[model samples]
Each structure stands twice: as C-alpha cells, then as structure tokens.
Target chain A: MTDINFKKIIRIGLIVYFAAIALFTVGTLSRLKDGSVFGLPKFLVYGAVVLVLTVCVLLYVLHLQKRLKSGKDAFGLRVLRTIHKYRFLIEQLVTRDFKIKYKRSVLGVFWSFLNPLLMMIVQYVVFSYLLNFRGTVEHYALYLLCGIVIWNGFNDCSTQSMRSIIGNAHLITKVYVPKYIYPVTKVLSASINVLLSMVPLLLVTVIYGLIATPKLYLSFAVLLLPLALLLLLVFCIGIGFILSSLMVFFHDIEFLWTVFSTIWMYATPIIYSLEMFESRAPWLITVMQFNPMYHYINFVRSIVLYRTAPTFLEMGITALISFGTFAVGLLIFKKCQDKFVLYL
Target chain B: MNEERKLMISVQDVTMTFRREEDRSGSLKETVTKLLSRKLKFSTFTALHDVSFDVYNGDVLGIIGRNGAGKSTILKIISGIMKPTKGNIIRNGNIVPMLELGSGFDFDLSGRENIFLNGAILGYEKPYLFSKYEEIVDFSELRDFIDVPLRNYSSGMIMRLAFSIAAVVEPEILIVDEILAVGDENFQKKSRARMMELMGGGTTVLFVSHDMNQIREMCNRVIWLDGGTIRMQGETKEVCDAYRI
Candidate 1:
C-alpha cells in the first residue's frame, strides 16, 4: 500500500473508533439516570461499545491490507476476459457445492429450512414453554427467530467463506482465476440457504399477526430489508476476505471463529430483550447500537415489531458501515491472494 | 511449407532455482549450530539456466530432456502456468496446455458437466460448448457414464473423458505434457491419431516428454533442454540422437 492510502485508512479507523466511543459514553450516561453506578446498564453499554470499535478496527486493517498488494487487479483487456472466464467458474463452483452437498439425500434443499426450524423448535420448547420464560411466548419466538436466523446467515456465510479459499487450495494454486472469487462464490451459495431460512420466519410473522402495525406499510423499511441484507452480505464479504487470508498464516482462525461466534450469539439480544436492560442497563443498549449487524437485526426487528423504519440516522450509519466493511474485505482478499501460491 | 516460416513462440534467458541443504559435516554441537544458525548450510540448485528457443507455426517441436532437465518448467512457462525467474515468453496465438490429466474435475460433478466445466476453463463459451458436447462425449466413448459423477469413474475412463474434451477444444497452439504415458496403450495410440488430426488442421504443437522414440516419431523439430538451457535445436533425429545418451 502506498503511504497515502495507508494514512487515509488509518485516519478513517481512528475517527470511527473515537466516534463510536463518544456515542457509547453519551448513551451510557443517558442510561445511568435510572440505576446505580457499575450496574448491569453500565456493563451492557461498555460491552456494546467495545464490539463496535473492534469491528471498525478489523475492517480498517483489511482495507489497508488490500491496498498494499498491486498484482491482483487485471488492467486492460485482461479484465474483461478474466471476468468472462471466472463468472462461469464461480457459477460452476456454486453448482458443485449445491449438487454435492445434498446429493442423494431425501428432502434435499428442504433441509435448509428444516435445520433452522428445528433450532426454533428447541428455542420455543426451552424458553417459551418449558422454562415459562417471563416474556410473551409468541413475541419471544418472533424476536428469537429474527435474531437467530439473521445471525446464522452472517455466521454461516463468514465461516464458509473463510474456509472456501483454503478448502479449494488445490484449485487456487493450479488455476489462474482471481482468489476472491472463491469466497464470493461461497457467500452466494450460503445466500441460497439464507433465503431459504427466511421463509419460515416470514410465515411465522404472518400466522401470528405480529406484523400488525400500520406504519409497517411505509414500505421504505420493507424495501430496506433486502438492501440491508445486501449490505450485510457485503459486510460478510469483507469479514470473509480478512479471515480467509489470516487463516493461511494462522490455522487457528477457523477454530477461534467457532468459539468467538458462540460467545457473540449471547452478546446480541437474541433470547433476551433490549428492554430487560434498557432502564437498568441503558449504556449497554447504546453500545449495541454501534454493532453493524446488531443495528441491521434491530432495523429488521423494528420494521416488523414497531412498524416504523429506523430513523434516517440509523439507516445512514448502517449503510456507511456496510460499505466500509465490503471495501476493506476486497482489499484484504487481494493482498493475501498472491501469498497463497507460495504457501501452497 | 519450406524451412523459412513465422515463429510462433519465443523463450529467452529463463532460469529457475530450488534450494537444498548443504553437505557439511562437523561435531555434534557444530552440526546442530550449523543447522539452526542464521548462517545455515545450504545450496542453490538451478533447474533452468539461460534457456532460449523459438518454434514457428506448423512446427511440431518436441522438447526432449532427462527427468530434472527443466522440460516441464519450459512448458509451464509457455503455458502461463508458472512464471520464469528471468526471461520472457512471447506467443502469437491461443495456447492450450495439457500439463496433467483430469486435474480440473470436481469429484462431485458428473462427467458431462465436467466436460462443460473443463471446456469453460479452456475458454469455451456455453453456446459453443453445448453445440460441440455430443462430439466430445462420443469421442470419449463415455456415453454410458456421461451423467455419472466423476468420482466413480475409473482412471482410464477419466483420462479418456478429459483428453477428449481437450482434443475437441482445439486451440491455435497445443502443448501436451506426458499425459499419454498413464493411459492404456490403446488410448495412447488413439491420442497419436487424434494429435495427427489436430496438426493436420493447422495447429502448432509443442509436445514435451522424456521418450526419445515418441519425440522422433511425432516432431519435425526437436529442442533438447539440459540444465535449463537449450543443448540442441534441429531435426528430430539429430536432437534425439544427442538426447538418447
């Protein structure tokens, strides 16, 4: 990377970190009014702030990395030809994944939906009925379903993409296609599963009459769900690029993600409500607001539950964060792509 | 038709190096230190050194060499699979390199699908491949197993299918590595006949192999590479005679 580009990314990283911290501090103080110092509210706020800052730093590092490597981009006529060639390659790989994964299986693709439904059943059985959870059963199911499904999408896409390049290390070394195409293909493949999982969630919403708010017809938030998902996919793309590249040098990244994701699942308010800690833990809610994925999930939840879209500010932050994540992912993937050949 | 013709491929001053440990003996402590020290014992082995050659269109040039003589490296360099440490490869037409047989198959994909997939990798668009699909399947004699996943195919069956697809996708220049060695003798004979047909259709072929008899029988010109440099470039008999030693 040139000194100028490196400096630009560093400046952006520092600004985001400081901005997130400032917002968390204000949000934390706002929550502190109703509770004692060092209470649950304060911990939640600080925890959420840390999550947002960590994501920002990770993304900026990926961005700086991609900018440093110079050989990846195809310059002139080669670009068009490469696109033409690799498009088929990516398509074929996706088809291979699809065909190979469910080959000779009964229920084939229905299992995509079945897997998430089974998880929902477990959650419903445990939290809603068995434990007699404090929240309303239907509302809890709706909330948990929304968060778990989206989180699964992000988790599956990132983990699969991180391994996509390494798993296809044979092809990457022998063939000349740009390396990013592998992870991009994995994202596309997992998207098929993600789309499948959404069906059950949508059905539950309609059947339960949970989406009854008139503002739900505002259509902007509804329209923004797909847009938001696209951004999130781009966000995963960026994360996938960084993790896959890092996994080459440190084989531990794949294992680390397994543990990290399990912990992250609890950090987001999947089983619990933001309200549980809002008055008692306002700072936590403010900090979670900074997490792009958290914001995305809540944005979807808001449209479904509250019937109104995220405020212009929330939508703006989501867009900016998603775009920045994608840019950085591309940079990291491009930087480490060449080193792959040597390591192999 | 005569001796004077347009050159199709040019290779200049190419070199490749591989590192190996040095043969230095010492006391146990000294040996251990020498192995781990910053100034470690090592040696540089050059696979190819200052190699240069050119082959013209309509010239069936065979590269003859010993096992470690950089023959494969030269072929890989011209095919754009491997970059040379210090040289340039200027080619005039599309190059199709058959470095290894059935290397591109995704075991999950069927034989028919892999034909399309391999064709795409070799630069064939979908429509053209679809049109030529029947011919490839027929030539491979793999019609019965066409829809079966490649993982189930025997080695010979896979080679036949892979070679058939590549043969049908006739590029302007064909570079065949020693894939013919592994297939059955019948398939080898079939491959020779198919190569003859490809050459008859005006494709330039640079066939690389260690077999001197095949080189003499197949190529009009032969370039013997030894220690990464061209030892001789002349008529097949002349070069193969020198390479036979």
Candidate 2:
C-alpha cells in the first residue's frame, strides 16, 4: 500500500477506536444512571466525563493525524515505541533493583511478603488496642492490612522514584536511554513488591473471614482486586513521574516529600474510620473525599472487606483520578525531561 | 566521494549551553534566602557555538580538541544524550555511544550479570548478547571471575568486561570518546585491535581523541574543534598537520 493510504487507514482506525470507547462509556454511564449498576444521584456527571474525554481524544487524534502527514509519529506512539524498544533495559534495571534491595538481607525476597504484614500488626495493636479503634472498624486487621498494602506501594514507588534520576546520575549523564525509564523501573519494582505482599494480604483475609465472621468474607467480588491494584499502580507511576521530574530541579523536594507523604498517609482514612471523623470533624471527611487514595483504599476495602463490588461512582472517581494523574504526570515529565540532564 | 554513500549523521547549527549557579546551594533555606535577597545568580557557558558537520557512511571521522573544546558535547548531542540548546542533529541507523564504558554497571551484580545489564543499556538485544556471551567472556578473559560480584573485580577487570560487552555490538554508527586507553598494556593492545576491527567492518565511526598518532593513523577525515567551533576540517593529514602546528 502507498504511504498516504496507510496513513489514512491508521487515522480511521484511531477514530474508530476512540468512537467505540466513547460509545461504551456512554452506554455504561446511562446504565449507571438508571440505578442498574449502583444507586446514586440522577445527575449525569459520568456522561459529561465521557463526553469531555471523547472530545479530548478526538482533538489529540486530529493532532496526531497532522503529525502523521508530516511523517512523524504521535507523542504517545513515540513514548510507547521507546518503551517497547527498551523493554529489555527496563527489565534489567528492575531486576537490578530487586536484587540490590534484597542483597545481604537474611530473608531476602521474603521481606516483600513480610514487611506489610509486620506493619499491619504494629498498626493493628496501636489502633485496635491502644487507640480504641476496635469497634470503629470491622475486621480491624484486614482493614488495616488493606490500607497499609496500598499506601506502602504508593509510598515506596513515589519516594524511590523521586530519587531514581539523581541516584542513576552516572547512567543518565553517560547514556542516551529514555529519561523516564529510571522512574518507571522504580515503580515497576515497587509494584512487584506490592504483588508479593498481596499474597499475605489475601491469606490474612481468608483466615480472618473464616474465624471472625459467620459467613466467609471472601466473595467472588474479590476477583476485582487486580483491577483495583492496577489502577493504584498506574496512579503511583503517574505520581512517580511528577515527583521524579520535580526532584531533578529541586533537591529540597526529596526531604519535603518524606514529610508530605507521611501527612498524606494520615490524611487518607487508612487507619481511622471515616465515622471517627464524622462526629469530631465533619469537614475533614468532606476534605478526605478529595484524596484519591481515600477512593482507592475504599474501593479495595469494598471488594475485600465488605465483599461487595464498588459503586459506579466509586469506580468512576478512581479511574478518573488515576488516569488524570497519569496524563498530567506524563506531560510534565516529557516537558521537563530534556532539561533534566542539565540539572543532574 | 561515492555518490551513493548515505549521510549517516547530519549535525546542523548545534549549540549547547550550561547554566552554572554562582552559589551552589541545593537546600530550601539557601533558595529562600537567595529568593528574598534577589540574588539568584546564574552564569551561562556556551560549550558549542553553532557547530555543524556531516558524516557519510563508512567514514572514519576523528574529532580532535583540547579539554573543554566541546568534543564530548557534540558527541553527546549526536548520540541524543543531551538536547542541544540550539539547532539539532539527525542520526540515521542504530547509533551506539561508548561515552563511558559500563556507565550502568551495578557493583552488587555479578560479572556475568553486569555483561547482560551493560549490553542492554547500550541498546543491544538480549538474544544477540546471549549468542555473544561466551565471546565476550573469552575476550574479557575474566572466565574465572565471571560469577563474582563486580565489587570484587579489579578496575582493570571491570574495564575489560565493559569493553568486551560494548565491542560485541555491531552498530551502524559508533560514537567513541577517548575510551581507547582501558585496562593494562596487554588488554589495551587487544582493545585497540578490537576497535580497529570494528572500524574496518564498513561502519561509520565518529572518534574523539587527543592522540595525534592514533587520529592520523585511524581517521580518513578529521575535524579540529577549538573553543567550541570547528577551527579546521579536512583530510586527516591536512587537519592533523594544521592542528599539530
């Protein structure tokens, strides 16, 4: 086929792909609005979201077509191509990280499995016994474990990625690999850790469900745990991209982020129940609603602890926050990446 | 001089600038004080000043310059490690830059592992590295220490491993920056021979070196950079003789 014909076909494919997603999103949104999925306000917030997304995607596709005419791939396509091209390098880096992380440690890779469980135990004792958060949350161990696993993944991924650029100054200054690879590998390694930790999380859920509850808390809805975790992983990668880029220019961000993330962890209702804030400070609950982790943690909790699928609104919020952060973070990273070598 | 010879790399009007902070303080307190005092100072150093050059296929081009003459900056620009402050570079084919050998090596990883890791970092496919794995180990002559951690390897041993991993890749365009003098005398001769072999195999080689003898012997064409500008560029004998004087 001629180059023009090939370009035309790809342009059409792009349009069709986006159009299909828009249709699917609209169909799902209408079903959700009819209260078939889950009960909520009749307002068409999701419809508006789908429409805006469709418009944005269409605009981008148009921009991409223009670039195609000029014999250039789209920015997103170039990014994907770079990732595919350097997949081996990324794999090696992640493996290097995993190896170096566990080197000289007695337990080694098992630390990934043990760390969250240990943190949950400490928090469980502190909150359930000392702080009187026992009756406040049902299946307190499971609740605390779920929150810790998700929060730790985000914390480790972001904090480590923040240092990835500077830590690999030798490689960055000497080599021409994609700058995003460092932060991305950090997130991937952290995600692997999260996946390993989930085994223990699930084991605890099963044991706690059988002993503490009349019915098994485990349900078919727990199958959606992967989707929830995938969203959280993408969200952490996005935050990683943002923080890593910011960290390149400002050294203070490294120290500042430590304090900020600790505060952010407490801000999210990880250990405390929202009900605890309902009486003391109702406004805090309203504020916590804006926190993306609050939605993500709640989404995971709804499936694992409550044995119910998340509400359509909850799913929509999590998806929006995750993808939105990812888009923003990618843009910031790409814009600032070329200058990173200078700063480093 | 052949009409069918392709332009392997076209560097046009490329300029690189580095902004150095007068007071190198990275903390928040210093930043805040500087901000309040209104003395946030930056001095810009232009490393390359509108430099332009082109390399054709299978041409052994040597760039000769003193330190701070922007020899490394131009190589970096062509290699895509750093974006030039002005203009651009268009490179065709898979360009392998040996800017610093084993730049991505992990001290905790074994010699065998570093070979693969360093190969991948240099943009070599895993299968190719696998095929050449023994060749690399044999060339580096570190068979006994292949499984030992890199920290345990001597610096010369590390250099041999790095050079071996890098040398195996048959890139269309190879960028070398004064990394020829690696390892002890024996390994150095072996490496130089290996480099000569690579340059002989119809690859477009862009070499930067201060060694007049090496440049005179190896290069078909030479570009002399002085103060970030091409002071002279022509046949190796003409430019090298001029540069020598």
Candidate 3:
C-alpha cells in the first residue's frame, strides 16, 4: 500500500515539475523572439543542466528510499529535523538579541527604521556634495537608501554572527544546543532590522516619485523586493556560518572582518554608481560583477530604482551565489562544530 | 538490582585530549611569526583517559573527583556538550543538562523573558514552558519581579529563578554539575527536596559534586575519577568510603 502511494506521489511530482519546466521553456522561447531574453543561449544551457541534475538527484533519492526509512536519515533531512526541534530556541534567541540591542536605548525599535535613513543621509552628503555624484543617478536618495539597506543587513548579519559562537560561550560550555543555531539566529535578528529599514526605502521612493518630473510610478516590480531581501538573508546566513566557525579557532577573524567589510563596502556600488568605475577602470566592473553583494544590491536596485522586474538571469545568479555560499558555509560549520568546545 | 534493567547510556573507552600551546597565538601574524622563528610549542593534556561506564535505567550515577580529575569533562561528554576524542556514547533519551543554571540567560531581558529563554535553551518547547510558566514563577517567588530586568536581580534571586525553571522540567536524563546549593537556606532545602523528588521519580541522573555526603545520600552508583582516569567504580557507599580515606 505504501509502495503504491510512494510511486503515485513521485509520478504526480514529476508531472508537475516537467510542466513547470515546459512553461518556463515556452516563456524563454517567446522572449527569445523579442530578443529580450538576456543571454538566451547561456540561460537555456543552465536550465537544461539544472533539469538533468535535479532528475539525477530524484533518482538517487528514490534508490535510497529503503535505506532512508530503515533509520539513518540523509544529511538534509537530519538538518531539517534539527532545525524543527530547535525552532523555539532560535525564536527565543532572536528575541533576546532584539531586546538586548534596544534595551537601554531611548529610541528602542524605532532605530531599525531610522538607522538606514541616517546612513543614507551621511553617504548622500559625502558622495553627492563632496564627490559630485548628485546628478549621476535618477532618484539618487532612493538609490542610496536601497544600497545602504541591503549592505547594512549583510554587514550587520555577518559581523554579529561571526561573534555569535564566542559571544555565547557561557551557553556553549554548559549546554547541548546545536552550535549552528547561534549564527542562524544572528542572521535572522539582523534581517529584522533590514526588513524594517525597507519602510524608509519605499517611503523615499514614493515621496521622490511625487516630486520628480516624470513621476516615478510604483511598479508591480516592487513586489519582488522581498524576494531579493530573502536571497540576501540566505547569503548572509551562509557567510555567518563560515565566519562564526572560523572565529572559534582564530580570534583574528574579528579584526580582519572589520577591514574586510570596509573594503567590501567600497567594492559594492553603493554610494558610487558603476558608471563611475566603468569610465576609469572598466576591469573593476567585471570584478564587481563577481562580488555576490553586487548582484544582490543590483537585484534590489532593479526592482526599486529601475522600477522593473529582475530578469531570470539576475534571479538565477543571486540564487546560485546564495545557495552556493550556504552549502559551503554549512559544510565548514558542520566540520568544525565538534571542535568548537575545545577551542572555546 | 535487576539484571534485566535497560541501559540508559553506555559510554565506551572515551578519551579527551587537549593540546595546550606554550605561547598562545591569537592572530595569524603571531602564528606566522612563531612558525617562522620555530617557537611554536604545545603540551598535551588528557581530560579523560579510556573511560568506560554504563548508566542503567533510573540509576542515579554520581561522579566525584578533585579539581582537574575529569569529573566535569565526563559529564560534559555525556551531556553532548563536548565530543569525545576517542570513544562512543549512546544515549537513549532526551537530556536536560543543568551544568550551570541560568548560563543562557540574558541580563538585559526581564525575569519573565529569561524563563522562556532559559527553558528553550534547555530544550523545552514553548507550549510546555507556557503551561509551566506560572508554576515556575510561583516556585521562584519572583512573580512580583518577573517583569524586572535580570541585570537588577540579586545573585540568589537569579539562582532561585534558574533552579525553579530547571526543576519544573521532567527530563529522561538529568545531568547536573555542582549546582545543588542555591538561594537561601529555605530555598536550598526546597531545591534539594525537588532534586530528591526527581531522583525518586525514576529519572536516570548523572551528578557531579564535591560533597561526598550528597553523593552518598543521592546516588545508587558512583565513579571516582583520579587524574583523568577512573580510579574506582562501585556502589555509592563503597566508592565514597574509599574516596574519604
């Protein structure tokens, strides 16, 4: 009876999966006629490779179904189980981080909204007034705000998570909670601030839209802002895992990260436009393209500043980078976690 | 004792070694310089050496040793806080390790918030904590001050709160390390009674304490550690008698 049910489920799942793939292929083909499918050939190749890889994975899972049921779980399943078991712990820790951060502050949670605005203003003055980037980008305030919000989320998440394991030494030495919970929760709490800061970004966009000449209309593309932020959050969590694990062994990572993030902030086209770098050093733009933050910030900019839907290629790149980093970070974290107690 | 009793935990040949650096390097630069100058040196210290033991169902096992004799290390290994360098431990049930009470509590959080946070850290689900919330507060006698931040809490009050939250949970295996003394005289008596109640309720326990009297009173089995190795293992009375001499 269970065998039949499993076969039936797999059949339905494959049908749905193939149907979605067919629909996407047709959409890509339609876009191809208009010559608007960005790098169509490459996109199709990646799509085909992804399809084949997923099919192979499905087959492998089916082959291992018997072993999976007998007691030993797959790695991903074990991770999910661990996550499910400790979800409330994660929630409590995140709450603790939020409370502790704003405990003594008079402003309290309002700072999450105000922090990005203040940062945008500081950068706007430095770049626009001093560097004469005032007229460079349309809706420059919104542009700066968008970049700052995403960059700050990444910065805060990575920096705070890097310290999470060491910071929670009192707990680590005494308990058996999964070590990964620390970095994961830090990313989650930091993302809360990122989420709050988006309100100001939207407000600026609307206020600027009312005052601008060609009235910047709020596009349906604005709906994709959350998707972009989710991708950024995933990327941050991955980086958090890698950094926190490393920080346990090497105390120097903290100082190194300070210098690293500052350099990283400059590499990302936040205050300065990519056009500025394109003119003087064309090669820098290529290097910037490789930077995951560049893709993430650009993804946000495409939605809010450009007022357009991100192309599938852009979405694909962000997903790849985010999940790829996540995979690597998880691997490093899992490998090092058992040794953390010794180092701590 | 029944020979057919089930094993709650079986620890086999566990060994833990710590490599201590003569001059600890906290940075890459220092490490690189030490490597270049041939000054990097390390000394090995074994915290546990080929330790093996079994905890039967509902057996209250006590571990006693002087400082650096591996009592805490063994407890930590069994509680799953630290991985053993060599050996395996098979645990049959959930562990609530009260190695240090209120270790996961945040001082900035309110007394009420710390209860949920500490409970969660000890692996209690939200609904469980919610049901026990009022009871924990009542037991801690901190209902009036539940909303107050823990930073303002006196050390005894914090210990009372920690013990109350910990005591309410019914764990399959309870691993505690030298934290029995808590709060004032009245509260300590209450906490000791609570501990006895949990022990009497047939929960397997691994306890580490310096007080031989406490071990003799509480534990059915005892393992006396000496210099990272098990020097003796037998009935609590037998082992405690030997250690006292």
Interface RMSD after interface superposition, each candidate: 7.3, 1.2, 1.0
Clashing pairs in 2: none
Using DockQ, give the best candidate's number. 3
**What interface RMSD does candidate 3 have?**
1.0
Q: Is the docking of candidate 2 incorrect, acceptable, medium or high quality?
A: medium
Tell the DockQ for candidate 2: 0.74
- Candidate 1 lDDT over B1-245, as tens digits, reads 57777889988777866555565342344556775875565787888898888878888888887788888767767776556667788989778776665666887789988987777666666777889999998888889999999889998899889888878866778887763533688878887688667756667888887667667677899888877778898988887777667
**Which residue pairs in candidate 3 have backbone atoms (N, alpha carbon, C) closer than 3 angstroms, thus clashing?**
none
Q: Model 3 misses residue B31 by how many Å? A: 1.2
* Model 1 stretches astray by more than 4 angstroms: A1-81, A129-138, A210-220, A279-281, A286-290, B1-12, B17-46, B50-52, B84-92, B179-186, B232-235
What residue runs in model 2 are displaced by over 4 Å at the alpha carbon? A1-80
**Model 3 lDDT on a 0 to 1 scale:** 0.86
Best by TM-score: 3
Q: What is the DockQ of each candidate?
A: 0.18, 0.74, 0.81
